[model samples]
Target: MNYYKDNVSTNVVTSNCNYVVTVKDWPAFLNEYNNFSNTTLAAYNAAYLQLGGGGNVAPGVSFLLKFGAFLNLYKADPSSDEYMPLKLNQNNA
Candidate 1:
């Protein structure tokens, strides 16, 4: 044990850190979240379009973007949307 410790490292240390988070406005926060979602969906659409829609891209660019953004927001809030039902309806068989 002594030999292993000596060879592995000269010393060991522990970390002590603290963090604070602030969210002042709920409505504003939700608004900004959808704004961010819009930007992200725009990027997704741009990427998909860049690839050039050929076949089997899995739905249209706009729907796919909204679906993806919904997933991310649902992760944060666990709320409702059209795609949520479809996602929850998975067979799992």
Candidate 2:
């Protein structure tokens, strides 16, 4: 599986079924994420146009900005109340 940011693969991991995989290149991943977060609308719009602009790209961009902002906040202070742990259901597989 590949984790992507700004349509670029940042990390790649292979898994079969019974083992755990760790992302060893955290710095590279963070760099890619920061790049995506700092992308300007003009750049995004240009890319969108190049991809055959058919739908409004504003909403997608807005979502990325919002999510990136939240991530930044969490990175700044993981102990902050704004950070919440997701509760996963134990019964679900």
RMSD list, candidates in order: 19.6, 14.9
lDDT string, candidate 2, 1-93, tens digits: 255432332221223212112233556557766866799978866655544333444332333333332322111133232332222233310
Candidate 2 deviant stretches above 4 angstroms = 1-22, 41-93
lDDT of 1 by residue, 1-93 (tens): 645433331111223211112333445546757766878787755755655353334333323333333322111112322221122223220
Provide the TM-score for each candidate, comma-separated: 0.24, 0.22
Cα-based lDDT for every prediction: 0.36, 0.37
How many backbone overlaps does candidate 1 show? 0
